[model samples]
Target: MRDLKDIELFLLDMDGTFYLGNKLLPGSIEFVDTLRKQGKNFMFLTNNSSNDSESYAEKLRKMGLDGKIEVFTSGDATGIFLKERYGTLRIFLVGTKKLAKTFEKYGHKIVQEDPEIVVLGYDTEINYEKLAKACIYLRKNLLYVATHPDINCPSLEGPLPDAGSYIALIEKSTGRLPDYIVGKPNPLMLEMVMKKTGVSREKIAMVGDRLYTDIEFARRSGILSILVLTGETTLEDLRNSSIKPDIVVENIGELAKLLQKESGE
Candidate 1:
């Protein structure tokens, strides 16, 4: 197991691991503050592409957790992938207005028709027209990419349909799957983080609530994984599953103590 003291970067999940809706998780702010004080680096990583990083940051600020911390979304990762591989192709995006705006900001043109590529995100504002168009595009067998493979996004009300759910809908309709699913458990996002931070896999850790996306991200990326029970996952779920978290804690509060102990503070 990778030692906590050696961890230099903490790639964190937003909704369940760090905070739930507007309320910050217990010790979340203290965890980030500890990282800052200990000279460690951390970034908020979310599979939800409904909003841009700025929006999440703004939400954090409003929740009294203001800082210079950077946020990265799967949408950002997918945008980077598109810009690097298919920069010239006009793309049809099924997502929220915020996600569309970020795609355009990343230099990808969002077209209404005759698109060469189709990217699916967690479209909270999805309508019948958007789903119908996506089905049509998938039926045409265009190059398809999705931001993340999360089937459901956590919400205060209940789990919401996310990109993976839409992917299933398209698959059932057209028998076509995404050419690429660029998000957690794929290791691409973590690679981008490594590139940006110059941190090795051994020195980086992923903290999240989901086993498949979060723990598997660490497994696939050769990094340490910490699973917190403050989310959708339960102890029984952890035991019944094959994917294993390197460390387990009740919440970020406990994680803060473990980190402090590892550093001999």
Candidate 2:
């Protein structure tokens, strides 16, 4: 196992790992502060494709995390992936207005009629009509893509259905699965991180609360994984699971202390 001190880049999962909903998790700010003080690199990474980066950054700032925050969402990754692979084709995006604007920001044409591809995201504004249109496109055998494969997103209420759940519905409707699911565990997000930060695989660590997306992503991408108990996974879940992280902590607070200790602060 690589030492915590050796991990140069920390890829933070926002929803459960760093913060739950609009509230910052305990020590989230401290963790980032410690990283900064130690001259380590970190970025807020999330699979939520409903909102853009500025929205997340503003949320963090409002939650008392200071500084110029850098955030990358699966929506951003999907846009990049589509742009690089298909060169700004017409897209039928089943997502929120923010997500549509995000696709447009990537230079893709959003068309309700005769789209070249059907893209699925974590559509918070998902409606029957949107799903019906996407299903029709899928039946026509247009290229299908999804932002992330998270079955459920952690919520203050409980685990809520996410893009993966929508995927299942679409599969049942059209008998078609996404041609590509571009998010955690697929290595696409990590590749984007590396491209942006020039960070090597071994030196990066994925820290999150979920075992499947966050830890599995680290496992597949050859990066260290740190699981926190702040959301989703319980100790029993960890013990019975095949997927395991390199490190475990009660919360980001514990991890922050570790980093501070490591830096001799």
Candidate 3:
């Protein structure tokens, strides 16, 4: 609560926190607007590596979200990690078009036959050939990297298999895990956010619905955190967890008001 005034940037989650399915969550936009009016900046920092930022921008635009706002994804964070660490490595990327595009844009070579490193993202287009090839690569002792470690992604129907599931399968098959998981809860995502926003750790507040990824990212990165109940987390979920968010609210709308009051807006 006392940290609200110190927050110069808000890192928000999208799926369950801001929207569900195709519908925007109540007060999501008003919250952003109010934050903007308070001279505070915010960015949607999603662990969903299924889509690229441009696709996210389009989706947000349809929800009356401003198009100019920067949206970061796990894929984007991975891109930065690779560009700095192994940009020249021939990479076998098991991911969607967006993830492939992210790597390509960073000048990383995408290969299928015995890559130096195998990067995994939320490949919704995942097939046996890709998975088998990934397993084969793992068997050969190639470096493995995952975009994020989410076990399931929430959907309108139910939870769907995410990157963590794939990692588990590959690990079971080859007895190898990712050399590095370059997304939320790892602090690499927060490093990327810091580089992009030019905002220091103390000035950034991570707001989201998930405890393990979102709130854990904040805790690990020394960034303030707010957990909203408008998503996968309930009050019960909070009480059962060891990770404590700095603030809790029914929705981002409520947080906006609290921030306004704290900032004297």
> Top model by lDDT, which number?
2
Can you write out model 2's per-residue Cα lDDT over 102-206, one digit (the tens) per residue? 888889989999999999999999999999999988999899999999999878999889999999999999999999999997898898888778989989999
What's the lDDT for residue 3 in model 2?
Answer: 88
Error of 3 at 128 (Å): 0.6
Supply candidate 1's per-residue lDDT for 107: 85
RMSD of 1: 1.1
Candidate 1 residues 102-211, lDDT tens each? 78878888998899998999999989998889888878879999999999999899998788999999889888899999999899988777766788888999999999
Provide the lowest-lDDT 10-residue window in model 3.
81-90
Alpha carbon lDDT of each predicted model: 0.90, 0.92, 0.88
List the pairs of residues colliding in candidate 3: none
Residue 126 of model 1 has an lDDT of 89
lDDT of 3 by residue, 1-265 (tens): 5378878898999999999989888889888888888888989999899898889989989878873578999988888888887666788988997888877777887887758899999889999999998888888888889999999999999999999999999888889999999988999999988888799998999899999999999999988889999888999989999999988999988987897887776
Better of 1 and 2 by lDDT: 2
Assess every candidate by TM-score. 0.97, 0.97, 0.97
lDDT of 1: 0.90
Ranking by lDDT: 2, 1, 3
Winner on TM-score (2 vs 3): 2
lDDT of 3: 0.88
Off by over 4 Å in 3: none
